[model samples]
Target: MQTAVGVFGGEGYKDGIEVPPLMVANAGQSDRPEISSLNCPPFVAVELCREHLGVHPCDRRRSINEYRSLFPAIDFSLIENDDDVLWKADTREKNEEVAARGLKFLSWLWTRKEKEIAIVTHSGFLYHTLSAFGSDCHPSVKDEICKHFANCELRSVVIIDRSMMGSDPATTNYPGKIPSGLDLPSDVADEKLPDEGKVN
Candidate 1:
């Protein structure tokens, strides 16, 4: 008999955390029958898949998925955390207590299995988010990200998700759930949100 395990844990503070015995048994247990076609330092820079998630209302801010998209390959089943919605812009439904309204179709982008993804959004989102690239680069590079993208102007950029670069692929984010509500498509019920001590 043999076993293998991968723990993709991030820094966090929680009141109570527990592990199932089944997982404790797999500490050194990875024997993936198939090696991922992806190479070491996994990354995709070609043939991006253009995705459409329909449309939804929004008063835009850095979306919850924006944080995760920076590392899209981390399998979702292993993650466990809350949906941080405080940054919500008053751009859509006024229910600040509920962040799903702002997310609309955005969450779907993260679920797609394609390694190369193309996101289509307004200039405002591109302007602010691209700023995350930092201003220390070449003047033109800084100018491109900082400037409003003119109509039909296309720029090539690279995003890095360190998790996929050289880490074991079998890790997990624990009890994390996106949209914070299991029913992301329908109205998110308040109760479905994870209880503080139970899920954090």
Candidate 2:
């Protein structure tokens, strides 16, 4: 989302504010160009979706490489990649697949017990995530959640319950399906916050 990016220390930021740079979570390829232009360091998460899932589009790999070149001083290997979720959502089935991967990936993050994380991913995948897990919310709220979020715009989604997963079988990735002891709540609510916040 461009608005999210702007407030998160991307281009067009107001002067006089010394916002600490946020670590770019090397995720979806769709946002790579925007993230690369953010002028921030990157954390190449192994769980991040590769360019085109290592599939079509020859330029995909080239594009990612260009972004990688922007951060030569950083050691991307320092951060271990996890094989949780990494796929693009092109069709309905593809959406489900990527959404499942996202749930697994997010579950893994919750297992880490980290206080916070900032993820810059494609809008389609993100929509699948909400549609799958956020079924309990009012339709209006759900529509509102999806309606917002322009490219490079930043949004903070608070996962209030780390214990339960959504009731929707389509969205739920039970613990048995993943690594031991990692379970995510099935039902989730988006705690809307103003775009302004500390850079992740």
lDDT of each: 0.34, 0.44
Q: What residue runs in model 1 are displaced by over 4 Å at the alpha carbon?
A: 1-111, 167-200
Give the Å error, residue 72, model 2: 2.8
Report the C-alpha lDDT of model 2 over 1-200, residue by residue, as the tens digit: 22233344345334665533332444333344323233543333333332224233331333334433443323345234222122233422355676676666666666554577676666655666556664544565456555635766567776644245433233223332333331322232223333323376
Where model 2 places Cα greater than 4 Å from the true spot, the runs are 1-46, 49-59, 62-68, 73-75, 78-93, 164-200
- Give me the candidate number with maximum TM-score: 2
- The clash count of every prediction, one per candidate, is 12, 18
CA shift of 88, model 1, Å: 9.9
Name the TM-score of candidate 2: 0.47
CA lDDT for candidate 1? 0.34
lDDT of 1 at 185: 16
Model 2 scores what on Cα lDDT? 0.44
